[model samples]
Target: MTTRTPDAEPLLTPAEVATMFRVDPKTVTRWAKAGKLTSIRTLGGHRRYREAEVRALLKGVPSIGGDM
Candidate 1:
């Protein structure tokens, strides 16, 4: 989507995403680095993910603009 409003899409932490994928948190970070997941950075450089995208992935759907 071209316009993603912050309030409309909920955010997920790396741990939360890992839990959904049954992977480790570090693996989730690796996925982000590999461009498999779309990440939003916090001021402190922590990553956040879109809940919808995460759910889509859990259901075997590809991310909106991601590698997987």
Candidate 2:
């Protein structure tokens, strides 16, 4: 099946991702560092995750780039 990519995906904070994964916020940061999750940096140096990617992980689906 072909999947369509959204032009503008919603970004999520570490805490928000943590809640979705039922993990600690620090664990979320570690996942970013280890490349388990992809993170985007803000101008203020905060990390943001793509909501679609995170949801895909929760559902055990591979992301677009197939990192997982």
Candidate 3:
């Protein structure tokens, strides 16, 4: 089996990000829209987030660009 490196950044789905922050998935979408969080869009138009960014926000640490 292929192994993932511990330092590898994992992508999180909107639902996962929402669950981590204890907010609704729609709220996560709103955050993306408001530029509070950075998002990656799937070809299908679903939003994905970086776990690192999410965790930083959770700790009340703003992103380097101040998007949070």
Instruction: Supply candidate 2's per-residue lDDT for 16.
Output: 99
Model 1 Cα lDDT, one tens digit per residue, 18-59: 998888999999988888888999778999998987888888
Which lDDT tens digits does candidate 3 get at residues 1-68? 54779986798999999899999999999988888899998678989899988999999897754654
How well is each residue in 1-68 modelled by candidate 2, as lDDT tens digits? 53548876788999999999898999999988888899999878999999988998999997644553
Give the Cα lDDT of each candidate: 0.85, 0.87, 0.87
TM-score of each: 0.79, 0.80, 0.79
Ranking by TM-score: 2, 3, 1
lDDT, model 2, position 7 = 73
- Model 2 residue 8 CA deviation (Å) reads 2.2
Worst 10 residues of 1 by lDDT: 59-68
Better of 1 and 3 by lDDT: 3
The local distance difference test score of model 3 is 0.87
TM-score between candidate 1 and the true structure: 0.79
